[model samples]
Target: MEPDIWGIVWLSLKVSAVAVGVCLPLAFALAWVLARGRFAGLVLLDAVVHLPLVLPPVVTGWLLLLAFGPQGPAGRWLEATLGVTFMFRWTGAALAAAVMALPLMVRAMRLSIEAVDLRLEAAAMTLGASRWRVFCTLTLPLALPGVVAGAVLGFARSLGEFGATITFVSNIPGETQTLPLAIYSALQVPGGEAVVTRLAVVSVLLSLAALVVSEVMARRMGRATHVL
Candidate 1:
């Protein structure tokens, strides 16, 4: 209803979209490695990647702050080399959301990667394709459905992310106060019941739409790969 409400919705979508975009490829690559590799300590890597899934969001945010805070090593490197900063910024919110969504995305992609027949990849290699080529033509295509599902799931999760985003970026309106933050703020005061109700409806609708779209994308990808 209010312009601020629309602004929050738009900001939420943009942050979610950017987080998913940055995380999707990394998730796919890591999923493939975990699904196929037998290297030592792989389990440790997997656990680390999935840590945010079980950890308290506030704890995750605090860890992120320690790692990317202005005095942190990464923050120093980023500031010196890339002229970039994330602390207290919307980008920090996206990072927190992305980390929170990582486990779901990786799980979907790992399942998809495992579902692909290794024999098909071998067959592709025998046809004079390099390992890279086989991955591109066989493994990746076969895992397409999972990739779409993972990306969509991550995006949807990021859209509603609050605890970590707020902890990392402090929920500044028009910057990091996304949909969930906006809803929470609305509910904090008297006489704002209507705004909160509308935001709740919006949240539900957005989540439902994400689920529907993900299913559609997965089906399309499956058909393209003849995966059923």
Candidate 2:
């Protein structure tokens, strides 16, 4: 492969990896709450968490832009407080990918958390263990496989993310030009079919690998649930 192609591939992987890493903990927290929390407006929280799944990618991207653009409120706050910027940056691409992938990650993890025997948690608490301790020692361990699966799913989704990323980050080469963006760019150029094909193949292979790993983790989650 050409060095340019390699760079696109690497950037895609890096963005997707960072997206998943940044999203996993938040996804897990939401999943646990959806699975176990009993609160008013829980349904509303779930709906908000899943809004990205129903929204058009372009719309989601646009919303992200309005919220994270340099002049936007969140963007201005982040820049002013933390000296961080996401506009037209690779980090912005990762943020877009993470938003797009959040629903799937939370759904997978919620299923796993819900499948965990509540009885075990109660028993642990009965033994003088704090709620946090029960969560860390029993709940999290039982749900580990599902968390891994959710991360894999998020990674796959991030790898394929295009519309939101392009809209938010503008597809800068060697910066925010992930695989899907590169493929889109290639499609516009005359005689760039080869580049498109190569990148598409890599994207498919990476997505397939992520799916396979997620499947394995899901099976492990099932076994753990069965044992419990």
Rate residue 113 of model 2 by lDDT. 94
The lDDT of model 1 is: 0.86
Number of the predicted model whose lDDT against the real structure is largest: 2
Question: Which residue pairs does candidate 2 place in steric collision?
Answer: none
Tens-place lDDT digits, model 2, residues 77-182:
9999999999888999999999999999999889889988999988998899998899899999888877887888889899999888888879899999999888
Residues 1-228, model 1: lDDT tens digits: 343888888888989998999998899988988998899999999999999998899999888888888988998899899988898788888899899988899999898899999888888888999998988888888888888888888988999898888887887888888989888888777778898898889999999999888777766654532222
Report the poorest 10 consecutive residues by lDDT, candidate 1: 219-228
Candidate 2 runs further than 4 Å off: 1-3, 216-228
Which window of ten consecutive residues has the lowest lDDT sum in model 2?
219-228
lDDT score, candidate 1, position 69 = 88
What TM-score fits each model? 0.95, 0.93
